[model samples]
Target: MRPNLLKRAHSHNKQTLNNLLHSRGTSPHPQPETISGHKQIEEETLPKYNPDHWYPVRLGEVLHHRYEIVVKLGFGMTATVWLARDLQADGNAGNRKYVTVKINVNTLGEEFQKGRREIAQKLFSANPKHPGYSHVRFMLDTFKVKGKHGDHLCIVYDVLREPIDLCMEKFPGRRFSCPKLRILLPALLQGLDYMHSECHVVHTDLKADNIMMGLGDPNILDHFVQNQIDHPAPRKAPDGHGRVIYTSCSDFGEPPNEAVIASAKITDIGLAAWGDEKNTKPIQSNAFMAPEVILQAGWSYPADIWNLGVMLWDLFEHFGLFDRIDTKPGHYHPEQHLGLMIALMGPPPKDFLKRCAKASIYFDSDGQFKHPEYIEDHTFESSIVRLKGEEKEMFIDFAKKMIAWVPEERWTAKQLLEHPFLTKEKEFFSATPSLSRASTASISSMIPSRAVTPGIPPSSSPNSGPNSSPKSVPNTTLLPPRLLELVPSVSSTECESSTNCEETKTEKLATNNEKSTSRTSLSLRPKMESLVESNNEPDVEVPNSKRLSVNKANKCSQDIIDAILSKGKNHNHRVSPEAK
Candidate 1:
């Protein structure tokens, strides 16, 4: 253990504080029987899987001693994953700290090294001091696994016991409340920005199941194992359905139904680029591919926006817009993807579709999709998902901008960042360096200092309702446009009202940005009944004053007996704390 970390632990219970500050969602625990490896685990398991429970992977096993593997938190194509602990770890670490580790000397030979590099790059990017600030990024601590097969890189990270996807899965039909969803979006966006903007990387596999949350550091000797229960991978096609399902849309019979604002971080990258695009690898991009990417038209950053836009659409409608549609077939050529474009959207603009250069998209007379000859055996079906009201209008707008058949027409990250919906969320949930010693020390210093500018400027306007406005906010594109509507007015928010207030506040107060599940149900809230009512203002009641119009201010006190109420209550909640 680092000397400083040990010294700091003596003064501050950093471990407890770390647990309290984590931002993970609580997924339901499996039944005792199932957990113990003795029940019919749900279809969430895989073909080569154990249905009963979760297990952990610990790299520090031989390096240290006495630890055991507990559960498997996540898995990628290259390696198995586990959450582990060492009974004899240094300091109080033996008590059970969540640690994640990946065994490298498994499948996928060369790609393994690339994944290792990605982890290394991701760790560097995750550092606040690093040029690429990532929220969903992973950390890599190298370890050796010496078996008959030899050794390799084992990635390690803080463990996230519960994943948000499983949490949503347990709830089944209930959509996340606006505040709850907002809390997660910022981190997901920052994560995406890291992969896209800083790394020049594309996460071909962006989905709810891929994104994870973790707690603390995992040294080499932690308890670890692997259990194939509650598979977090994308769901597959059933016999009759015949189509692989990437997005889940559980319909709970209710009006104003909310969807799981899916937790998104790109995963399963480079599969599309690793091999011959013409040969078609066994791995697939599935429904997330944009038309430009599908057609292989010199794609770039906007391709990610296209995928994100589609992901948002799936969240709202419960299915992939282009899923089941055989956009491309016959040797997995990019040109065949045009079939998907025409199906999801009516048809691209002639100029846009004309970029096909290689294949025929239409007849000379109509410029319509005529000979879409790719799908022969399999009938193409548009997931023809429906959208309503504001969602419909907003989604279509974003879809047009993102899913343009032509790559050039797609919206850039800079443009999406400024969209009104996103701008509002960005403004409200403005992330500031929360755990800086300088800021804390300054606050504790006795000397007077210049007025500080708040990270997200507090609202000082009369129109301080739900979404006050999108002006004055930069980096707005961190959220999907439709979801941005609920970004609370940053100034007026309190722990009591704004659901996202907690996440935003913590991201401000601490850059560590732990995911926590603290929610208040209105029905269970304690009413302010004034228990000491005996001495309260009553009996000699003053004459009722006119209701304070929102347009005016009203302030009065006992100091002025003849004080007249002329102004309205301060609509803006930016109050300065008074001197003691």
Candidate 2:
């Protein structure tokens, strides 16, 4: 087992609450070791674990004059979120206010555009007047600048302190309380309602991390300067001669002070979208997605409502409702990913399967979701992440309403706010200290936290779970980071060669090379095409929208129409089935 690769594997797995709850106590199982980086030492004399290669790009390095980068707040697949200061907050709310900047070098491709439409289109509440539309900005005022490569997009936003997840982590002693949940949820519901009614939007990625607190009434220019700062140029330090003194150390000086957005507005436009492919396919955080989303049924605000329910649950219960999904394929059947729903709402409605495009992998006959090849189960019994008391019941009730297999069955965000659980929060938000988040002592302690597949396996037991063991894939070699932008992914690899022969071709889809299954392309039957089909087909003329072309052909109105026909209502939705 090469220690460096092992650490990375461990870090990626940390996103799962199960790993956070119980993965540290287990012994390090030996792996197929490889040679890289430093020389191998005796097993008894391994060096300390290092977190070098992947450090957050100090906020200053990415942006220019407006704010300073304090520290990394969090990160996702394409971008890293930062907490920084805005120099123009007081006199120029028009300029620099504290902001959260999402820095992504990745091109965003289809995912970014889908999210843009979701939030730009509607709010994620049940009520016609969810407050989100009233306050949140659909598009982030942003700009772009040069990086080590050439260009990168920096999405500027009104900064907020801790995310809801961090807040829950800080508050350990309190039970998922009624008063607190009430105070918080209504504001959330109102915001969602506003977005839905005013913008016709839906935030498909509704997780604690995405919901923020800051921005009462954001000044209009809040987004304007953000655009400029994104691509700030490196300034030359006065060498007593007005000459620039370039150094390897920090670039942007006095980056803004990172803070909880004194008030937060809806952020992450890349995750919000307008159309409904059915609530079935959302590019959502695994822990918060609705069952309809998992089952491939039509979904819309209800999916966000389910996410809100989890947020409501987080107010009292520190634990996310469905944080224990097995990561490996063939562990349980795909249906089992709906464990929280099954546990709270009972068996799915009979038509649930009919709406689904059967899973590519499962743990057993019951059809629970199996882990993907890149993930592994490294849970340890001794490490326990606990959330007890009334909070548990509150979460269960919320989960029931949010994850019903039937889209219609799930509660709307507005409906959720009206529940007895959070009645008092109707008046203006009872401002809470975003900075106070949970107690540090409680958060500091927790159990810790994958890989390519060798083969696809089926389960013998209907009650089984995804294989917990790890497996290796063919290509683990690290390539130059530049490939992310310069090289076209996959198939282009063949074109890179000077020989340019048909041999050594790079395949595009799995079917091009292997008989393997993707989560979106699982046990598909011909009739299942309904999952991707749409009732109303647009004119033959193609609509012009593509952040990145899946291929000019895939962008044709007919192709999108076909996917809808095959996948059902959710096909046109911003949340693609291939959402990470």
Candidate 3:
């Protein structure tokens, strides 16, 4: 009976070997030694961190038999990030690859564990060769290791130099310059656009803390890694949960250069979700929350635009746009925040107010704040006191369009990309002439019919015949030739109606210009008449009061154009005043 059992076990082992060989597309028993060597190699390549006992992670302790912990990067609620060196990197001697390792403190919750796997799968699925991938922080690898409490998840990422918040802290007053903003905003928007469109994900938490400056110099990174290794700092005492706490320290002196900051990538997408998904849970930091989010109204992509507007304001002002007041021990005054929004952006449109579930709590039926005293002592004009003439006008104009009471009215990422503020440079326009042409076309299509008065003879047009009226179009306003030059060719019919038409035309141009330039002082030139054109529909007649408002807006825009042109001359920069 013993001999029969032994023979059966031997036959089963032989059958398993045969199956393995067949799976490898090899004949059974043809390469037994090679198969045994492959198995040995596979075992060696597997992670070595013990699952039963937590490894004591000292400053110099190696992880996965590859990475050696060098420096504590930072700590969050659930994890501590560490800078580590890849000891197994290919080199003759001493040269090592640096990486950021985020170690979770405890065994992750079911939701977080699922999120981590989803993120890893999505990141791994992305093609590294795509240019869009450059804007996002890609995961290097992930593994599980035993911790003091339980098994911890360790996520590896490319070494990012610093978070934007920390980087900004080094600047004077923690404010970024317009030039720096120009560089960073575009990169950030590009990253966001890719995430929204390509990845089909919405970064529910978009803030300075989640945006990081990319690697600058490899030598500098190596130097910093070596310094950490040479001078190991003691880890702080573990918390109640027995997880070690560590403070981030940087020995690499001085803030990063503009190039590094310009390459900022969005990180910390732990709260990210599908763009179309219904997220009932609270999202985004309170200070950056959109009105839709605050009121518990349905939200989607436009919510992100609102967040961006607030972020841009913070970048320029070095403070949050919304001031939160502690009404109680743990509660914040949401109504006060709404009042502040009203004070800054004016009241929400009636349609928007109707949609807001909490509108009645904060605003009266007429759209005035229910508690006016709760409003902050601030206005758009007052907030931008630090900016000069054109800068202030451009900033306010751009912000108003984005911080609209109605989420649907906010300019989309793609539309904002073509705004004058972003395409102000001749080089930018020259490189992407199609965008400028498309923008011009879009503006021209919005030209109000009031631009062409009723009872005006066809002969009264700019291309009128020799027998045309000599009155030369009533209330004609001449736009700066430079402003006219910036606009693409409109239909002869639209151009011929009236000279005063230029005011509304230029006002619309300024609005578009303001949209892009306010974030970063991009050179924006106003396009033609559209202020009276209600919501891009030309046939609608604008009330006299609205027309007057358009006139005032045009006058202000004209002033901004003159100031911008003057500033350009002072800086010895020249932008073409020629029509494309």
Best candidate (score: lDDT): 3
Please report the candidate that would top TM-score against the real structure.
3
Better of 1 and 2 by TM-score: 1
Determine which window of 10 residues in candidate 3 has minimal summed lDDT.
1-10
Tens-digit lDDT track of model 3 for 1-580: 0000011111122446645756435743222112221121211222442223333355667888888897877655455677888876755333237788877655468687787578656654655554446778877878877765577778888888667766776765576654466567767777766665556677778887788886676577767765665554433333334433333564355776777877788887767776666654667777777888887766666677778888876776745677455534247667777878877766677767787777787777887777878777666655553443323333454565467666655544544544444444322222222222223323222221122211233342322345534243222222344543433322324333532122322322232223332223233322331111111211221111111222333333333354435433433222233322
- Per-model CA lDDT versus the true structure: 0.36, 0.38, 0.54
RMSD of each: 19.5, 26.9, 19.2
Number of clashing residue pairs in every model? 36, 101, 11
**Local error of candidate 2 at 529, Å?**
51
Winner of 2 and 3 under lDDT: 3
TM-score, one value per model: 0.49, 0.47, 0.64
Candidate rank order under TM-score: 3, 1, 2
Mind giving the per-residue lDDT tens digits that candidate 2 earns over 181-289?
Answer: 4345555666665655455567677655565554233542344334334433222222222222111111122111112221344555565666433234545666565
Q: What does candidate 2 score on TM?
A: 0.47
